[model samples]
Target: MTIAGAQIVHEKLEAAVKLLEVHNVDTWLILTREGYDPSLPFVIDIETQDTTAILINKSGSHQAIVSKEDYETFKQTEVFSDVITYDTYMDEVFLKVFHILNPKKLALNISLYDHLYDGLSLGLYHWLERLIGSNKLREIEVTSEPILKQLRCVKSKAEIEVVKKAISHTTDIFEEVFGKMEIGMTEKEIGQLFVDRMKMRGVTNGLGKPYDLPLVCIVRCGLAHRNPGDHIVVPGDIVIIDFSLRCKGYVSDIARTCYFLKEGEFEPPEDVQKAFDAVVDAITQSIEALRPGKKGYEVDAVGRACIEAHGYPTIKHSVGHQVGRATHDGGTILGPRKTPPRPQVEGLIQSGEIYAIEPTIIQDCGLPCILVEENVLVTDEGPEVLSKRQLDLITTPYKGVK
Candidate 1:
């Protein structure tokens, strides 16, 4: 049987067709070198070491033109309908496709506003201009931002299942790592434990910001604890483990908070519990208010309001952001209600989009940061929480002194 990703890729291609037609784009070009393009994961399945050009049109046409060395690898993905290989003369092959299709409104993966659609490099831009000449280059629309962003925001069933698998591993790792935590263990040790556990499970990287720098994912664990250091986890300290893993091309962003107990303590301190409750309430409010046609800022207001209602200061970052392919999958951001004029923040929330609703409280009742992040899918009915919500602060029973 073909794996679920095959079906998901097919769905994505179909969606791309509709999006092209809606936007009146004749051709959408994604040109990248060394897999720097963010949309590559959504469109092309395999990794490419050399330059690649994926051309998509409204008529259900998908073609991938890549270096001869990478041709077989790209074809193996089976996502594209046509795969063309080129050796020394890449510009010739690219121009041939350009002349054949002769798209009036060619859309390239270049955007000044959102990084999600701005994967085109300066060198690639110059190469493309030289390939097509200046006059024909005028037809280039640079309108792939909304089209590509929309395609990624909506999660197909197959895509959702992949993310769920990642989440399962993440939650399981949390249990195992937290179980071994002792009072004398330094924060760095805890972070390293999570990293080692992920590597043991064959997970290579974790996403701090979705499209994170190469090795930064391993140490982006400060969401629960401060920057990993030699500081020993004290009895009163509440540690938050905010981490994500990339599994099978799909990424999982998850976080859980635990309290270090004093001797004979059965549960978390009252103040911490209250703050945790407030964070939960904020997430609940945001999830309840999420639906198709709702604006990003509006949904953010629901969570921000709830946090402030509990006498906590307003959150510094966005209430939530879409997650898929990258950690901070840009496009629709659940930001402040009184948002400044920004493209994604002011955009409408559509059904089929996946959002990470994470409301954070800084220095809450003497705690450094109290935060809870949950993944949710926007459905026609309402928001569907993907990751299991952290209802109560995980209580770490006192392990005796070292």
Candidate 2:
């Protein structure tokens, strides 16, 4: 898929220009050292050893000041217009570019609110202050949270396709396990099955470490993991499983629940189905409430209300989050928190952004917690459900042979 290729970088850069104009900022500065900042992926492809500063102007000019050793590497990316290299210090090249651009306002990646935009280190932040001269820094420096957040949150056509592939592969793995899972299998055994299925599909862990199982098949009432004594799956036990993985660079996070029934049983227990219905209701109402220009808190409130109205306790976390490069890729949140919602949370939902709306209900009525997370995209018309929605409770027949 040429994941994070030059084309994606160019597209994001172009979007950055429009976003900067929308925010009325003249210059966007991405300062990084040792890749501590997450926004570096959007600006450059090559790894940087020393402090690198990328200057993107609202007038559509891209200039980069990188270490001499990384100059050729950054230049080969074909995304930046001009690449300047520095050996001893970056002060000379940094001032040289700023003087030429002569922008009155500059956007820096420093935010006390959103962690996604708070990529710049305190040491680098102070170094930039000393380098840019105190007066010019004051006149120009503004947080780049709004501009970069919008650019990263909104998915392009190509990105959406990659996300779909990830979701599809995840669904395939879950379907295979549903057919083969047995009542005597332990949680570890079930987890291995999911891993084996993912490997068979040609999707492995894209992280630095080896592949890890992504299952959350809790069997005992309210217990998240199996104990050392080996708790096995049994009939009448509710199993809630969550599976997610990265295909190419995009990620898919999804979950579903099923009930193990005794022989001749065709449906789930009445109490379990009622709780599952509440979870489905939350996802449906939340999606219906999703539209461009609505705030995160408003959308989250709708889902939370639905869960509570159905006689279930509301989920503690936010209703959902923007899904992209990272699982919790920061952008617009689905709901507000008790800590007070930031501007990122209150920001209007824009079309082309993807979010995972997960509303969970912890049932105290002998049923396991029902948590359903689905991926959706916000469009001009409304919300478009990306992953195939789970409409009914999965009923797996149990032979009770164990």
Candidate 3:
């Protein structure tokens, strides 16, 4: 947990190296100078000290080119084979390092296909090109998407523990917030409540807030705030709250509607409940179908077919996403639009991977209702629900009961 959490990241790097060896990736390089400008944070999860450039090879080799100021910091880990220090720029440092390694393919953090490929900024890419002198750095492929997607997508035992804690805390917060919500409650108030609850929860082992911010706290009342937006909640309304939270750098997301109703004012809307049920069933069946060696699109199709068969429109978003440090960890989309399947969602849902199969729907009615949103993870055999399996409708009575 040290800001120089570099040592810990070194462990992750070592783990990545082992994985790269298994997968036959000759080398994986993380090139960055000012830490701040890199796609990842200065105290990034990958670890290592200083604003250093890293290279992990299939030959079980590791190297670090650090800033002179951070030479001691890099030494603290003693993990890399070459811990070279530089002052002005890593341009010459990179060339020297590459000449020594002479790798057939040099992978860089640039991906046009995957969202994460853009982690290496265009400007930085230009800088790297200039430093390496273009052609010298032949086979400089934008392999960031595949490398990072796999390294991060496939969860570790330690990572899963963090995610479990995140799921536990977020669900507990939802339970408490469910009681506080009322007809006249504003969306911002509820969102702030989630923030406050997280603070009260405090950090684990004094580790601090675990980066647990409800990045998205949705409060959709009536039909105004149904979709993700800045709409306010009002009295005598049908409110739907769809939110995702991150804890300990692990994320958990759930979207359940809160209808503000008097005890006997109106019967539970059958269509809305039905829509919610459909999503639940779809999620259940899809998760059942989830297993290693099965393509992601197949699982996505299960959920898509469930709601679509019920005569409701399929959710626009993907059925699920690979979950990790960021909310949308790279791997596969349960609901893939591309034909022949994209590489990300093509492979099986790996055993160590965790995911959020959040399929949402809106029943046609005077008052809009976002059907269901819950969190689940891929497992050795199948999918597992992370939250306290929400089955029935959450009836928020006059007192705002959960």
**Candidate 2: worst 10 consecutive residues by lDDT?**
221-230
Best lDDT among the predictions, by candidate number: 2
Query: Candidate 1, residues 9-45: lDDT per residue as tens digits?
Result: 7778888899999998998999999899888767766
Q: How many backbone clashes does candidate 1 have?
A: 2
Worst 10 contiguous positions by lDDT, candidate 1: 211-220
Which stretches in model 3 have alpha-carbon errors above 4 Å?
Answer: 2-11, 36-51, 139-142, 203-236, 263-267, 339-347, 364-368, 399-402
Tell me how far the alpha carbon of residue 364 in candidate 2 is from the true structure, in angstroms, after superposition: 3.2
Candidate 2 similarity to native, TM-score: 0.90
How do the residues 278-318 of candidate 3 rate in per-residue lDDT, one tens digit apiece?
Answer: 77888788778778777888888888888789777777777
lDDT by residue (tens digit), candidate 2, 27-107 = 998888877788886776556888889888888988989988888888888777899998888888888898899888889
The CA-based lDDT of model 3 is what? 0.64
Q: Rate the local accuracy (lDDT) of all candidates.
A: 0.79, 0.80, 0.64
